[model samples]
Target: MHVVAHTEQPLQAHALIRAAASQPALLPLAQQLTDQCWGLLPGVHRLRFALRGDVPQNTHPASPPLTRDRLSLTLCVGPHADWPEFAEVLRAHTTGACETPVELAALQARIVTIIGAGVAGAGTARALAERGWQVTVLDAGQAPAAGASGLPVGVVAPHTSHDDSGVSRLSRAGLRLMEQTMRELLIEGVDWGCTGVRERRLPGKTRRAGVPLSWLNEHAHTANDWTHKAPPPAPDDAFWHPRGAWLKPAPLVRALLAHPNIHWQGNAKVEALRFIPHEAHLSHASTNTARWQVLQGSTVLAESSRVVLAAGPGSAALIATATEDGSAPRINPLRGQISWGLMADLPSGAHMPATPVNGHGSFVHKLASPEGPAWYTGATYDRIHGDARLLDSDHAENLERLKALEPDTAAALAPLFATVGSDAPRVHGWAGVRCGVHDRLPMMGRVPHAPEGLYMNTAMGSRGLTLALLCGELLAAQWHGEPLPVEGRLAQFLSATRFRSNA
Candidate 1:
């Protein structure tokens, strides 16, 4: 193995070492450096040392002594004037001696274009950039979170099934990864929370009857024993999820796209993908160097060797353009609406719950708003296309569900109900469209029989918050030939190729 280190300032070099030491992924390398008693040597110092034994003494005047079986280390001081050279050397050492796949190895220091500024696109860009790839994100809208991710608040929780099904397992894994990401990147209380969620069993719903309360409480939570005496009086048995929380999606999306290697371009909608053959570019160009031109009508938006289509519903059209057969996955638009009202609008005796309640409809308590403390509820799901307009009927439906779920709270807020959706000062809301597939699972991975560099991460449906980051990690892992963040079977389950047979 070989290791190379470089930095302009001595303090920067030490900081790099400290950072590596603290990172769980690089701690082993840090330990090796510690055992070798490596110091801040001036200029460039090359050493050959064994990992299993003591450091070897210098034997040659011009070169450091080499043990029978040892790794080589090189340290370069001063500014990195030639970044390309440094990146190549760093890539070579990190990838080891030709062990990395030829295709993945060629992608090092290359550029990748991601279309979409939503959670999926931003997450994918962040992952690729973290691996040293230059990532450019282009969106049709003027800024990030212009799609379904533009919602005011979204809940994050692992799905539960009686048999621990594939969706359940995948969601559990995704939830864990998302929680870790929030801890590392988001501000607690402001950006997100672990305040827990109360799921009320709807009337006549018996799907959870066979499941044990202890199991539900352990995996999700029945009640916060420390804070509340009993579960909310809505369901036969209200289930509590301590790990579940709500987040402001826009902030998280911005934070993910803030990476130094990621470049965000708004209003650069990609209308189509034109695959350029490797032979067309150059007679002997590497297959991995195949390029694709992203187009906006007749204009070319950008060109790159790699492209990730994560534009939600818009991804299906791009995939169709790239395919020779003009075939694309069946991505349907599911319209949803959420209703919110000021906290002061509640009747004199009516009060909001301390925690969010989820049943046929979901309710969030005391979300901080510019106007004042506000509560949000409802989110009517309808299979409608191109209907972003808010409907008073949907608002009424949401109120009905809330009345069924929490009669006390509903009765208390009766005063606001008379004026709901009539431009009432106390009542407000927003609506957006979410994309979903027939199977309810997200479509991800390389697009089959399309361009070699084309990939898709779409149809996330309502679980975008929980699944986007994990899917991005999976895509980057596959592209880099690294160990997958998810199991092989699960990755296969989410593959975009699954729909090809049907198409």
Candidate 2:
């Protein structure tokens, strides 16, 4: 539980420092300390930072608040017996410099460490380690899931492309493996239940005649009788699912980190990756290690042979060195915002079927909440060039789309707009971003030109909870040189090669 102040290297510390120092208001204060700290410890092997404070300012009422007031920060440096002198330098530079740098750094690392942090990188590393690969996951955020993987709840489904489409096929295979992985992995308090997913059928035959479409435009009805206390006897003509599940994404992430084989260091951001014939060189925010190091302010944290860029969309920006014909993997960031509501008027004992209402890529699910009859109605997919802003217009558009799918349900669930009796039951919602691959399937293979030891298991797009387990297993198999569970051709469905093929 105690996250060491310094790891085998310094990259982790460096990332933590840069992220903190980059703050506009904090930059000036940090710069003064960094210049002095780095100069004094030219031979310093590591730097650590820890901050305790009140939350940050927030203009929007719903946005997560930032920490502010009564803050404490710690910085730790290695190879320096006189850390007090170094600590004095940081104290002189800050306003409330009560705590010494080294003292605080160790405390912060231990606090954050014991709480159990790190997201995709940690999860992947843990999985690989269970399979016997010594893995160290590097992250830039103070905590994992700070990036795109931070959604409170994520849609879980087996997405299919047009019939026999490569992505669809891959999704099917992935779904099967995912089911198996969930069973094998022990994730606690992670509510996972299968509800068949569906793409709704056209309302009536007449409406189908007017639309022109691509192969993805299959006119189909998706039916789940969970609306009624007793599902209508299987409609011979209805489309329904026998399997689907709701997953708590955060808990799933924590479960992935529980394995013994993986070691993780949060805030270890990688800026540049230099590929050698055998190993890859990582550039940390704090250290100029000949190899890699963690840094805080102007210090280093840790380093290792393998680094997985599981920072979601941010990985795209950091992986500029792995270009193929002027392009890295064709990963794009898609922002999805969703709203939640409580169906106050619905009949009791209504089983909320976990099926998707398609055509607009919107998905819905029912979750147990203290508030009555809560449902997750969301997700408008908007392609933004690195924008994480939760726009008001996006929310309105999502609500409008929901109206079209189930007008009565939309109207019955309208209380999210204002204060209502707490006992009446309402839906509370959230929005998040999903990392998508150009091929519409997840990218989960080793980076071709990078070191043979390096691998990538990200680009999960919209289905992280459903796909993460399966993708982890697939990657683990590849690492072991064992035959794949899915077919070879299907494996290519998820390859980075899609970034090149004109198709």
Candidate 3:
């Protein structure tokens, strides 16, 4: 539902004419946008429209409601040389509101410091950088995605429930954003793929009730694009996700960190964070000069008027350091291991899946790797302690889960597990620890009980690839007062303060 159009002439002079000629019905909206478009600056501008329909509104909550564009229009007023800057930039300029807010005119420093170089931090850094913010990403590791996002390969798919839960809707929005980012950045087959996934629902795996409401029935066709029935041993429980994709998290993280406005500083582990107040003066009496200082012992690593803490498992301790109450949200470490091997290692006539499959555990086949074209599966989840090391017991656990997810494929690959003596396809294991909260949703927005500029984007659990990009966009949208990428109600679920409201 995205379109790209270019214009070489004076945009303001002929915008209405072009719009009016093509879609006469939208003349009024075009005129409204044109009239409010006063700043013809040499940068990016977003003019939004909230167009409501004349159709009858839904009377009850049981039936699904039909919605319209929740519209937006972007205009780049610059020369050809500046097209690249204008095209990629998305500033929260114009308020995108009916009545523009005056506060947006008076601005603070645009520099922001993001702690973490994984998908969560890099994603947020990229979102802010695209909006003209100078972003500094700090990481304890030698390079980015060294944490849980270091998973060799992962899947992106929408979550579904009988009632269409908040996580379900938010996941769909995340997948859309992920796809958009992949198209803009990363290699198609090597870094990622939109190859549809087949999900096999098994006993005690599917979350559903006895009956589905009319709301589900009404959106079935639209949902088909995201997920649809696929023929399998149990057709009723099987679903095919057209938008689903296999993603190499490290590559995407690197791409996000590659934005011109983002500067990455590795091995700069933040020991503590403190909000330093600016001294009042007669010449400059504003409170905008205050900054959050990132500290390691006595040395200050960096300082910014705005700060985002996306350090994954390291976020809780940082929040506790900065907050007055000395309390932080409960983010527990969930360790997991994924098993993989080269495709060439498999013996002749070995069963191979055409596409990725997910249910009890996920199996991604024929993905490009340093060794060769490889297949991956397993990812046993366990409570984390100290370091998350790859275990032989966990490898056995993965094989058992694979047996349930794809019995034929698991049976075929079972021999490879014992190929330790020979140079045959040997099973390799990778383990990492992912953080999560009591509620499955990610923790986003400004950190409660903390300083004004302090924010958080973490605890994505196993949905890092699926939701990280969207979380970054959501954080940037909330910061810039832009229209949310997802519904407003669904966004409230991700608020960092949802569990600590009193704080």
Candidate 4:
């Protein structure tokens, strides 16, 4: 079983408290209960409790509070079972408060009914549900992908390399998988397109050794390997293809919610998970519950022999909270910003380089804009602490850097950049965080030495659009006991086990 101790002073916690105390007169009772729990659990830090889903909800309650100010709130979650004994214990504690014991009991009952709504839970639920598994996706948010998946547009395409490398392999594979799935599913406005990507070769650029290269030919990139030779005119001819595409990240995430067998619930955050020899128990908080109670707010969502963790960066934290050994590779959060521009005209037939710009630390791509001829040149990779809000300085610097690469294209891109609301026609832009893995490849595979059931797929970094579908399939392979099509060496390259062992 895993235990998560989360502290929230604003928003969620406050909202939960307010909802419980909606009667106004119940404010004192609510505050008193919250205070009592907080005071007794000083070692709990901001919030503290030990949770093991293994203990049956039918387990009887302990005697009266060691003191009125001290109590343990256990909410039964996951599949509904006979939990009266456990429910009675929770009732025994909340007795003698402003409300009747029956009211408190009802509140505890409501806790287990709400489940969290998020991409990790929801996406997996959808995938499984489509396969005919009964699934429930629960989250603390009112919607799906409210965590790292909340990005407006997740940059799609391979990163760094175009072949065999871990990033490339996963990206190509993911792109193919997503394309296939979306095509079969027919969810519209997701904006799947084959917009070709183009790049201007720098004067003295060199490819990274050991990095496999593809698609570039006599005309693809401007050759700067030889000095004193002016680079050839940009590839105006439609000779090659490193074609790219974009997806409205939000709507696509929401579309995943359409699965029939998947139950998407919001305002419930998993507090704990208990692993029995054969079964697993889940503990979580809900909106309707007055205080935490076992089985009251809980429902057995799924009792699969396996469970996967696609929780993005939060997966590491969740794993850390659950494991007694406290061993799991931490996810690295990388921040990347994208700058958009209104283009007078993008080269009609020319293909752009969808791969990341190496030393320049930026990426440029085309966007489907209602306005005429629009392009997005972007993405400043800043690992340091900062805000997601776009910065003018970053914009100026990006433009200058972009201009230096292709002066001719810069002339055409400039006015468009300005008109978009910057110094040029480019007025709109955006920023999002990438959950990157320290090894620079995605983190995948089963959590090492833990129960065989737990699995993870995260840290796709700048390649979410190109990598999500592929990674999901990889996880599915493991869950189904099927041989992974990806090479074993590549699997090791992306394994979470590598980090856990190294650390």
Per model, state how many residue pairs clash. 1, 46, 0, 48
lDDT (tens digit, per residue) of candidate 2 on 399-456: 6776665555555554453333345423344666677775567776666554433456
TM-score of 1: 0.76
| C-alpha-based local distance difference test score of model 1 | 0.72
After superposition, which runs of candidate 1 have C-alpha atoms over 4 Å from their true positions? Answer: 1-98, 203-235, 280-288, 423-425, 500-502
Model 1 residue 134 distance off true place after TM-score fit, in angstroms: 0.7
The numbered model that scores best in TM-score is 3
| lDDT value, residue 23 of candidate 3 | 69
- What CA RMSD would you report for each candidate? 11.9, 21.7, 11.3, 21.5
Q: Give lDDT: candidate 3, residue 503.
A: 34
Worst 10 residues of 1 by lDDT: 220-229
Q: Per-residue alpha-carbon lDDT of model 1 for 1-503, expressed as tens digits? A: 34566766534555676786886655655676554323222233333333454444344343334444445455554556633344555565555522456887765347999999999999999888976789999999998989988888888876654565577657755765676567667998887887877766665732453332434454222213211223445354676666678888888999999999999999897888999866655545555456899998889888898899999978888889998798887889888888888887776657667788775677887778777877788787888555567777777777788887777777776667668656654556688888988898888888877868899888899899888887897898677654455445667778888764635
TM-score of each: 0.76, 0.59, 0.79, 0.57
Candidates 1 and 4, the one with greater lDDT = 1
Misplaced by over 4 Å in model 3 are 1-107, 209-216, 232-236, 281-288, 419-425, 501-503
Clashes by residue pair, model 3: none
lDDT of 1 at 319: 88
Candidate 3 displacement at residue 105 in angstroms: 5.3
Which tens-of-lDDT digit does each residue in 171-245 have in candidate 3?
Answer: 876776687678668999989998988887877864542212532465454446667667665347677887899
Candidate 4 per-residue lDDT over residues 415-473, each given as its tens digit? 55555543543446676556776667777666665553455667767666666655554
